[model samples]
Target: MNESYKIISSSILYWFSQKKWFVYSILIALFLLSLSTPVGLTLPAYHSLIILVLVFILVTFEPIPFPAIALLTLVLQVVLGVAPPNEVASSFMNDAVLFVMGSLMFAIAIVHQGLDIRLARMIIYFFGKSKRLFLMGLMTISAILSSFLGEHTVIAIMLPIGLSVIKNIDTQKTDGKNAVLLTLFSVAYGTIIGSIGTPSGGARNVIMINYLQEFSNVNIDYWKWMKHAYPILIIQLLVAYFVLQFTFPSSLKNIQIKGFKKKVQASDTKKNINHLFSCLIIVFIIFSWFTFNDKYGLGIIALAGALSFMIFGMISWEEINKNTNWGVILLFAATISLGFQINETGASSWLVLKFNDLLEALPSNSFNISWSIMAIISGLTANFFTSSATVSLIGPMAIELQPTDITFALSSAIASGFSFLTVISSPTAMILYSTGLVSTKLFFRVGILMFSISIIILYLMSQFYWINI
Candidate 1:
């Protein structure tokens, strides 16, 4: 009996050691739950805030799987009386969630068709003259494609092209390694910067749009979104090019290629009529997004595109199921639901009041200064958390910051796309890191510079450019 008790105790201790983050989150939640509600906030609102804290801890550490975290969010909402079961159910699934699901599926379809190979050929055709031009072209093309598609989709497609280029080089030398790192970083950061250019560019953009319409009644369409965000995208791309060049200098001036062109051409010949059909389908989807997104939400249009790909036999359902990350979709849905509850329970308004109180303490908390502060917070938060999750949580407070001015909301949404600070901040960064060429130390070093410049560019655009548009 003594030996059995010791074994049981050891097992329990081992389990606790493995799951300390989870235990810490629960204890924090309980401690907060035991406190009296804040003077101005309702019980439900206060409980929602506690859930928010719990979620931040869980997501930051990821003590459990993402789908489990998503399910816990829904369960906590009902259990804590933040909302009724029916309301929770309604909020769990929405157009934003659908868009995320469809976009992931869409990326699989595009890559499955092997269009990325053809895209690589075009990049080499246009900018194969000089090493600097090739790097610039990669960044420019990635930014352009990602503005319409998405960072995940563009990076998935562009990574292979960059790798193909790097494969032809000698990585044992310092210049060759720098060239490789520069190419990969260009693809990653360009895709990230361009993801803010349109409503369809990233799921976080769609989430912000949904929140804007649902909470603030501000109806911004695809073109309007592009008008506000595209200039900043262009500016960031240019700045990133120089920053990347400075960080990873390569003195080898000429493109040294023997048979890559011939190899790409040989693969191009294998493309049949199905590839043409795929191109047509993508063009139609982009047209629909630009022309009819106001009539049909971006989610429905994205779903329609995915369905088209399946109907035409361009991609199989199994392919999508195998490639898509469903946990992210569910987590986006859950966090979005929490965001809605935060607003409905008046928690966001209370937060805005408290924030305003803090802002007032500063000597020069002008409108521009306030906007910059919120954008900086959103960008910083996005660096630690997924951009979609950051928006799902921080977006409501932004809308509440200035109920009358939409600039505050737009800045927050756009700034959240600046996720260049960490490897896990965006999928593009993760994909780049997976190549094993870019070290974590080097990634963070360049990211600090890119993130800082991007924030400054965003501030300038908001002050000078967005107002005119």
Candidate 2:
């Protein structure tokens, strides 16, 4: 009897220890819900506010898998009467969610075809002469590809190239280590900066575009979005390169890439044909997005691209199903639904009003102050939560602040993509962190500098450039 009792006790303790944060989060959410509603607040809005707070805490700490958090949010919306079952269900699926799903599948298909080998050879052939030139070429290639192919996809393709180069280095000295770190970060930061350049680059951009259209009736097409954001992307790329050079100054003057030509020669005819076909499919999808996105929508075009790969036998369904991260897609869908609930229940508008009251006491009357505050908040939040979630939470509030100020709304969303302080800040950062060459401490150290520079650049752009454009 005593043995059984001890076993049960141990099991209970272990479960509690494993889920302590989850329990704590639930308690805090319940405690907040128990409070009396503020003046002029409806019960539904109050309940949604409580759920939103819970989501932020749970998502930040991640006491459970992100998909579970998303499921919890969906259940609570109905269980707590924040929204009807039908309404909550409707929010679970949308164009943004579809786009995320389709994009992930397409990315997996493209990566499965093994085109990275050809890409690496091309990179080395072009930039193999010197260390500095190679770094520049890597960053430029990463940025240009990511601006259209998506940050996660580009990183998946480029990360191995960086790692391969590092592996080929002949020395185990500190200088060699610095060279490896700089090369990896060049690809990582390039992918990150370029993700803001186009709507197709990241899901946050699509979420923000959806929010703008739904809330303000403002439609920013693919071309317009690129035109507005590409300048910032270009400037950030330059800043990132210089900052990396300063931070991890290379000791080597020149380095030669060995056996690159032999590898290029070894590529067989079938692989080359497959790669060329994949390239054509990618080009077609990008062209369609730029030209026909308004009619067929970006999500549908992405899905069609994935279908094209399958139709042409470029990739198998088993590969895509095995490799794709569907949980992320579901999480995005739930957060978007939660954002809709926040807006529908007046929670976002209430928060905006509170923010305005807080800002009214500031001595500066300049609109730049407001824009900077919003950008800072969005950027900081993005460093912790994913950028898509940041946009979902803050996009509505920015629109509520001034629907007419398209610049302010779009800037707030785009600037949130400048998540540089943590590996969890963006998928590109997380992928680079997986390389095991980058320590978390080093990441934060370099990331903080880049974060500061990006914020200042974004603020200045909002003040002068974005305002004019």
Candidate 3:
């Protein structure tokens, strides 16, 4: 009896230790629920806010698997009477979720084709001898590819090339080490900056677009999105080149391009005919996104592109299944559902009202002030959590803040791409960190400057260029 009692106690302690954040979140939820609903908010809205707080904690700490947290998010809505089962079901799946799924699958298909080698060859041929020119060339290519292919995919492709160049450098010296870090940061920053360029660049963009359409009845197609964002992307790229150079000044003026070329030549550099077909399919999908996105929606078109790859036998379902992050897809859907409930229950409006009250002492509650606040909050939130999840929660609040103006939603979305401050903020950053060369301290140091510059640039664009567009 004593031994059995000890074993039971030990098992309970183990579970508690492993799932401490889960316990803390539940306890916090209970504490919040014990309080009476605020005067201006309905009971349902208050409860939804509690759930939001619970979810924020869970997502940030990740005490549970994402799929489980997703399930909890859906279950809490129904249990708390925030929404009915049917409403929850409907909100759980939407174009934004579909777009995320399709894009992940499509990215997997594209990455499986081993195009990074070819991309490396192009970079070498164009800007290989001069270090500064090579850095700019690499950053430009990474940004452009990430603008369409998504930053995570672009990082997976570009990191290897960056490392290849770095491996040839003399890392034992401070100059060589700085060069290595600079190359890696170029890839990472480029991918991050370009993620705001179009809807396809990141799930956050698509989520924000969905919010704009659902809340404000405003539709921004791929072309319009690029028109608003690509200029910012271009400007950020130029600024980032200077920032990275200033942060990591290396004495290495030139690199041995011949060595990299020989390495590429030794590899199986033969082009596959199927690659052309894959490229055509991708181009067709992009063209369709630019032309017919309004007709079919971005999610449907992205899925169609993934299907084309499967239909042509260019990528197998098994490969995609193995690679795609279904948990994240489900989480996106769940958080999106939670976002809908927050808006429907009027929690977002209440929060916005409070948000305004806090800002009421200002000279004027103008759109510019609101835009800057929203951008800074979204940008900072994204640095701590995943950008898509950040948008899933914050996008609704942004739309509620300015339902009539699309800039609020757009600024929130674009600013969320400033995931430069932390190693775990975005997958691109994580991948770069995984190379084990760049330190977290270095990341934070460089990120502070870039993050500030990005916010300033975004504000200027919104104030100047975006207004014209």
Candidate 4:
């Protein structure tokens, strides 16, 4: 009994030590809430503003897990009477949340089938001899696959391929580190750029779609979304390839990826069948998303793919339950709820009103200035916060600012996916960083360059292509 008491005490102490910053953050938020009241804002709007600030700080510093921040957001909303309990609860289970959950499950099933090995073999078979060609192939594959399979899924599938090649390189050589960094960045930046290509590519895209539909009654279907964003994705993929190649030039003329094809061929017949079936299911899902998304949303179609995997016994629920990052799903749901409350309570409009003077100062000739400003704000904010959170905060404001110009508003949201500044900027970057081959400093160093290029590309697209579209 005495030993149990000591163990419990020690556990409590350790938890507090780990979470002290979070505790301080909560206290600071409450203090700020108590003292804050801008004139002409409703009580709920004021409270929402305080909560948004708290969330921004907590998410940026990340003293706790994202899900914890999300739970805190929901709890505070009810406890502070900023929103009704039922409304908050209802907001947490939207179609966007369901889509995230379903897509993650589908991703797990696809990864479980071990098809990426074949994919790696194919990539090497075509581009094994030339350093630049290999890098371009890897990036192109990552971009195209990510546009359909989502960035998290594509990165998870591709990271091991890049890591294996890096591991094969002679680390004693002076150019080894450069080769590894370039390869990893090819995968990382490719996935990041492709995330803006389609609604299923990332959660932020879906969230923006939901917001546009809900707030403006403007429905952007899958093909329409692709048309608007795919050109940017293609150009960015090439730009990332050139930027990575220029920044970290590989000295090796050729790389031999041995045994990948043999390993793929060694898989048994049953495994091959499973792989083929999984690919077909994924393709079918994408096709359906393109053809029938108006009838059945992307979330339901993704869940159907997951279900197909289960019915065919290609993947088990036990495996998915263990592998899935439920915290991310929960975080997305809570953030969506918070965004809804921001809009519902007039907090977003109030915030926009604060910026109205500056917006009015711009020349009245064209909306190019406003579009650039919105894109810059969204892109920069995404570097610190999750892309979904950035959209959740900014989407409502964009809609409030220009209810009729949804094309510009969505362009801003799409550009925010250019999360090229930090490890925490996007999940793809975090996954790549986890490989230990890429350093945080290197990520930022390369990211800032890519971020600048992305802004230029997006600005040009906004002015020329998007306007005509």
Candidate 5:
């Protein structure tokens, strides 16, 4: 019996080593659990959210490409009668999804035009010549881009430059490489922080708005989201700055180092007509993001941009078709379908009941304990789950619990930003991770420290946002 158990354990480990199996197994497990839970009306509806969350975790972490995992969950949902096939297909066409796609393509165009690099140089020029100031430029600029354009795009454009800067400085042993890592993370963190500042910043923020409107009376507009979120985001940026500086080698931290002047190598780089048009179409799409975005819907806008970019000039339609990650898109659509199913089937409500029941098990008279606990829960949960989903699931419920003071509500909301446990929680974090520039373990190390510090920063901000500090 012991031998059999050992063999089984070994097999499971072996399967997990293959990223696909690891992801699929996780989804299957979550699906079964959600289905069995007494949380919702139909197993398909309530169970779908649980399944979707699992899919989001897998895809965001990028152990597997998003497109593939998306299909599995989405297809499975339809086949299992969790969602109708047409509904599953339509989930792929959401405005939120298109908005993300348009943002990504626009970011690509900026890089292709060398605009991002030029912008980086400008940042360094303005900051002055000191290692500390250099670090500041790196973090601030990256943050700005990540917040507005996107973290992944910013990272993709900046990673090569960051590496080049250190390489020129003989950064190998002098903590130049560490500086690169810090810059990379700073960009990712900034993008994430910045994303909350705008409605188009990340999928979750939009989803939160939609979910709130759909399920409750709360209606958060794009501008209002910025107003409530920006202040908190600014505070996050400051925390990121000090934490990044102190955590890494002091020699490289927050330095305004010498900026790059090297031109792209003509040989190592090739610019094609297809690449050009691909980029142009991306630009057109971005233009539409603010203009025609709502008219046609986000998914249509993204597809239009992607299709037009493919047909335009950067690369051949075949080449663009070949290079793009369809699997990631598929995965995104699938997760949406699954998430909706979970909510519809009533599983979410069931879980809420259980949670409330669990809360009943514990004495909860003091607002302090409730707020602290909510903060901890929000931070920790979002580390593994998507931030928006975490907010949607916990936010309304937290409010429903009826904290004695506004402090608890603010704490719970801000604590949702503590998504540093894994790259999957935040899109910007995922984008940076996918660059293949930084390793998973390095991210793990940084994430742990960030999570720890986030607690203190959120606590401090609570004082400001709620007048507690």
Candidate 6:
């Protein structure tokens, strides 16, 4: 009897490990039952839970972009009585969604013209041109680009360069494993960290901020976001650098290859003109932001920039049609729509009740320690849900915990941005994983280290930079 029980348990564990769907389906069924039962969940909350489950299923099993999934989910919610039929019509269209679409499309245009290459080479020229220095240089450039362009665009721009450099290093029979892995990670992580700096950096940042404003009236504006978030981002970058240094092979030395000059020069020419113009437009946008916050939202300015680029033929109509991430947009919309319902219905509140119970068990006044713990917890939870979705789901609860402590609320949001260790964590990871530059274990190891070190940095920075315990 004992042997049979052990064998059965082991078999179930093995089955779950190989087929994740079995586990997810079981949990989803449970969530549904809790909702359908007299458990007192609101209709909107139930709808959001169902959509949330479906979103994960799509990401891991079916794989569709957010926008498409969002559109379909909204339709089905209305049709099937998940959400109110009248209210469902306008759920997907919002300033935030348009802002994301505009930023993504504009970034695609700018990167397509080789703008990233122009600056990447310039950084190499000025920052000194050794192999490791070039890697760091490219990483710095990626972070800067991602702050405005979106991390997905940062990867799109740097990925080709990263591949070329690694292939060149390997052409001479040198082991390229560490170099390849480092380059891919540096680019991916740079964008991931950089995205924390602004509303436009990653949609998650925007999502978190929007939810905050909706729940609590303490508006975090564009410049306000950078005021504190940039400090955290800089700390995270340092952490990523040292962690990468340790992970890199000891035998690997910086091999200065002047051979990449042709690539660099062409890249500069292709990107420089567009880059200069784009930079100017970005400057204009920033100025307009400070000068015109009440008159025009950032979304309008971003849309204006995208439209201007299109009119000037910097991006052809065909390119717009081809390069747009329609699926990501759809998925984001569905998640947002459903997330709104969840937040409204107080489902997230009950979920936080469970999290708060865990926190209360820690101590009487370990507020700082508790919030830091929550930061890491929020980030890990994002692995199962998206950063944006997780943030929206849990951020309100985090803020409400120590209502006097704004630091806890905001820091928790920033920490959730560091989902670098798994291809399953964020859209950026999914994008990089599909590139096939490194193995899953390599990506996982690199990501785990990066994330761990980043949490430490955030913890320390919170001590010095943020408010009291």
1-469 per-residue lDDT for model 2 (tens digits): 6999999999999988877889999999988887899876788888988888888888888879988998999999999999999999998888888889889999998888787788877877898677688778889889999989898899999887777666766446767777878888999999999899999998889988888888888999999899888998999999999999888877743243454445555778898899999999999999999999898888889898899999999898898899888888888898889889889999888888888878888886567777788888888899899898888877888888888778877787788888788899898888877877787889999999998888888777767786576
Model 5 residue 138 lDDT score:
65
Model 4 TM-score is 0.93
C-alpha RMSD of each candidate structure in angstroms: 1.7, 1.6, 1.7, 2.9, 6.2, 6.4
Q: How much is the lDDT of residue 96 in candidate 3?
A: 94
Measured on C-alpha atoms, candidate 4 has an lDDT of 0.83
Best first by lDDT, ranked: 3, 1, 2, 4, 6, 5
Give the per-residue lDDT digits (tens) of candidate 4, residues 158-260. 9888776666777566577678788888888988998899999988888888888888888989988888899999999888888887888777433445644
Best by lDDT: 3
Runs in model 2 deviating more than 4 A are: 170-172, 253-256
Q: How close is candidate 5 to the true structure, as a TM-score?
A: 0.73
Q: Please provide, for model 5 over 345-445, each residue's C-alpha lDDT reduced to its tens digit, 9 standing for 90 to 100.
A: 66656655666666677876454555567788878877777665565455544544442343444455556666677767765567667867666677778
The TM-scores of all predictions, comma-separated, are: 0.96, 0.96, 0.96, 0.93, 0.73, 0.83
- Deviating ranges (above 4 Å) for candidate 5: 1-41, 45-68, 169-185, 252-259, 262-323, 365-378, 385-419, 423-442, 455-469
Task: Give me the displacement of residue 87 in model 5, in angstroms.
Answer: 3.8
Give per-residue lDDT, candidate 1, residue 444: 88
Candidate 3's displacement at residue 300, Å, is: 1.4
Off by over 4 Å in 4: 1-17, 360-366
lDDT of 2: 0.85
**Local error of candidate 5 at residue 407 (angstroms):** 11
For 202-248, candidate 6 gives per-residue lDDT tens digits of 77777766666666666777777777778878777777877777786
Collision pairs in model 4: none
Please list the C-alpha lDDT of all candidates, in the order they appear.
0.87, 0.85, 0.89, 0.83, 0.59, 0.69
